[model samples]
Target chain A: MNRAPGLKTYAVIYLLFLYGPILILPLFAFNDASIVAFPLAGFTTKWFAEMWADPNLWKALKNSLIIALSTATLSTVLGIFAARSSVRYKWPGKPVVMGFIMLPLVLPEMIVAMSLLIVLLGIGINLSIFTVIMGHVLMCTPFAVAILTSAFQSLDRSLEEAALDLGESAASTFRLIILPLVMPGILSSFLITFTISIDEFIVANFLGSGQPILSVYIFGQFRFPAKVPSMLALGTILVGVSVVLLAIAEYFRRRGIARTGGKDTGGFL
Target chain B: MTFSPDRPTMIEFRDVHKYYGDYHALRGINGTIRAGEFFSLLGPSGCGKTTLLRTIAGFEGIDNGAVLIDGKDMAKVPANARPTNMVFQSYAIFPHMSVAENVGFGLRRDPRSRTEKAAAVEEALEMVGLKGYGARAAHALSGGQRQRVALARALILKPKVLLLDEPLSALDKKMREHMQVELIKLQRQVGITFILVTHDQEEALVMSDRIAVMFEGQIAQLADPETLYRRPNGRKVADFIGTMNFIPCQILSETGGRIEVEAKGLGRVMLDEDQVPPARGEGEPVVGLRPETLTMLYPGQEPQERAVAGRIDEVIYFGDMTYYDVFIGGTDVEVRLSMRNVPGRPVLDVGTEVQLAWSPSALVLFR
Candidate 1:
């Protein structure tokens, strides 16, 4: 297929516009000078050392890890139930139920955080890391369900029947056949939900209530000009972690497709 | 076709009925499958053949009847607890497991030691012509190999009855034909009651000792392959089994044990009482003849029994045999007949005048 030279130039410019800011983080992170300016400063590891020394940074990282891990585990478990039932069985109002479960994916994050805040307050619940985890789970479960549903849908129903015909009970068939086949999908869902929860700012800001979550703590650090270089160092490290996580998730997703002998369709990668 | 009539009943369905909401899937199914016999449920799609087979495997429950295996009622039997195994149409080989793991999946609860189970898995694999293939991953195998693995997996349990649901449909034509003969031989070697469900009439006829022809949730006829081909009970069964030329006929008289009919293009003929199957309330009566039953007499050849004058309307040449469509007896009725492409007999062109020889015993009267 032939493409016009003008279209090629436009695509290059579009990609540069998208990724140019992210590319500046590591460059500024390694600079010796604290001020993030154009002229190349001598490379140094001082910002990473400074960032590592802050006790509050460690606390925020711990809190964020707890929230992200909890959200990933809870939402993925819920997603397995919802996805399997949606794919393998028929019931009244199925579409309506699935639609409601997926509605959070499209709802604005600010609205969701605000609504969850109001509900938690009305129920006399304390705002803490636990509440932030709850809000993040609500925000991430739709993504988990969407990923796992495709995995369940690709499975052939006859495999389960064949297992049962071979004298395995329903529960044993699920343990021996269904769980192993969809393990890759479950791993993918866990990684994606963890990444989404860790990087989310609005929900963490609204629900943490000064709990020092990592994303909210980063936003606060930006207010102090002296902390900018260390924050850039942290951002660079985060970008690397997110890339590796998504790469692993995509690998598992592709492996799941191949294991089922299914054609690869669109995925997060 | 070595089925003995004295064999004991393995599975019996008494007034079996199944409904999917408003659609009645199986309407009062009644039949008995004999032990050690190769049986088939043959029908087109949506005819409940697969549903009926599932009933025997205990995968489907009948709404109004009892399913008996070995003279015991199976009303409360679940699929996992039943004494039947199935080879699915998709083969359903577990993609995550090795071929040996899949074949020995049913033996998970067996009391045999590890080495004993391994030997049994090897033996089952050899039974399906898949020895030494057990070490490979299932997803790496081809379609025909997957089918063999599924067969071995199901047969390893030594179930009282083995159900095969269109097991050869996914393979190429040559592979399907090859598997058909293999399945028949395996059924004989094991002497297990095999119940096959297929929409392919030729496959069912080639493999089964007896077959039940079904249409729209009802069995039209349950008989051996030769009886089904020579004497179908209804026009629909006749049409579905193979290519049959239906010629309009009028019943001249009915006697105590004979039926006389004046068939179009063939004049009057006397048929035995058994040749006339029970009426299915179909449209005008017709006499059906298979394409192979009618012989096209070449020039200077004598008619064996009866002959009719026909003009060759069309000639379809196959490598070993040729099919000729001829209009018979100065009438508009066209009947297709097959003639062998033999030495000294040239392929006749269209519009050639020919003599077609047929026997009255081969005609089935359907009303």
Candidate 2:
């Protein structure tokens, strides 16, 4: 409830700084001129059309979609279990387990990506979309787990206990009671992991070969002037998709907040 | 080994002991809760009342001995395997489930068809007076409605016993009063044993058929509410269960069914402690009385016949009764009287000389 002055300033500054560049992507994508530089050129949609016409672009988009979907599914299922156990039980090594789950979030992304690449190479796992999926799953699972752990932690464990006392078996009780209760947190975790997997650059860059992802494709397009605006169009679309996904993520996040009796503060006190 | 079908023994804690690591939670406790009895484990917080209730609910494992439900040992029985259910202190209503879904949650084992289960859910919801609120999510309902949903969910399974952990502690005063009466009626209709855990003595007194007063993880006294309140086992039991005014006294003589005590400040008083054990020739014996049993100060009363001479030092005026802290012969003693706000309470201000008196029978003698 406290509307402390300093945090409000920090929050205002953070929102503008984080969102300013992404907002500019859509504006430039619509710019008519091929060259993306200073000077107002009239608006056009040719780059978008140009991007659609490219076969390579389509293949990359398809590959990214497959990878992101698989990654999200893999991460979400694992995340749900990991989060539930981490929050619900008091195992002897719980602290160590939590630290391991959160390591990816705190560790540098490049280090994790590089380590995964080297580990995959050592195990003779080839560089491909499969490898890319594994990499994204690895990078995204931690985020998924972290997001979900918070969600599960906020829910009262007594609901599950109540269900069990009413004679629902452990497995069915989870399906019938705990899952529904933490669904908002579960969904936000899914979308966030999906977004992270789709938007990831390093793992896809290091692991993808013979199958380039959207991030890799976008990076390749940065060199050619003819491909610049088209890439800008592609980037614009990705940004919009990401924003929409993030917005949906935010929706579920807000829903989870509201569902758990979260504070209705404009900002944290 | 099993109870009869007519008057069943629904739940029994047979020498049950629970330990959380090294700390003993429920000591070798043995008790049986009959079907259709409203029983309360009354105690201060940390007295392991909740732990004992949880052990019956299958949430906590008994470290030793067995908790029996329908004469079956529950030591190895998981919570989900037991037919007993609980309404947690927080109500524990599934926030995601609508009122109907929550009620139907336990009906998964219904021998009836899905449609019949659905109908049963409706019946349970209606039983709790939440008939029309089936579709609304649990979080949307008010606190009282959620509590009913919790009750309905537990009841739908037709559990032999229902464990309620301080179920009314979270409610507002008016809501709690209304619910207490409703709960009694609901229990009568269901005819299942209700094992309730609460620290609120008044709540235990009002709702329970029998109250077990616990102290430091042990049941100090277990009896009907009337006996528990009136003839508490000792000074600790007396002090814990209700308000008491205790003062140092000397045992003058012991006889059948009665003993005379010479209280230091108060005059000779008579007490009945069931044959009055041989007098303790010790540091100090004490006489106690419940505040409600003592009468108020009166100017016209005989000064010499009264228990003590004292000045009323403080007056704590509760709406129903006014309590006076009197300085009787240098020892401060408290007395309470039901107020008749005619000329208002016998306006005894601080530092005022007041002569307090009590009948000899009111002197509750204790060593």
Model 1 steric clash pairs: none
Q: Distance (Å) between predicted and true CA of B121, model 1?
A: 0.3
Candidate 2 residue B303 Cα shift, in angstroms, is 11
> Alpha-carbon interface RMSD of model 1?
1.3
lDDT of 2 by residue, A96-205 (tens): 97788777777887898788888988999878999989878877888888878877887777887887887778888888877766777677777777777877888889
DockQ of model 2, rounded to 2 decimals: 0.59
lDDT of 1 by residue, A1-269 (tens): 45698898899999999999999999999998978897978999899999999999999999999999999999999999999999999999999999999999999999999999999999999999999999998889999999899888878899999999988898999999999888878998999899899989998999899989899999999999889999999999999988887887788878877876667777778
TM-score of model 2's chain A, to 2 decimals? 0.85
In terms of lDDT, the best-performing candidate is 1
Best by TM-score: 1
Each candidate's fnat, listed in order, reads 0.93, 0.82
- Give the poorly placed runs of model 2, Cα more than 4 Å off: A1-32, A41-44, A248-269, B1-9, B114-119, B252-260, B275-284, B297-307, B329-345
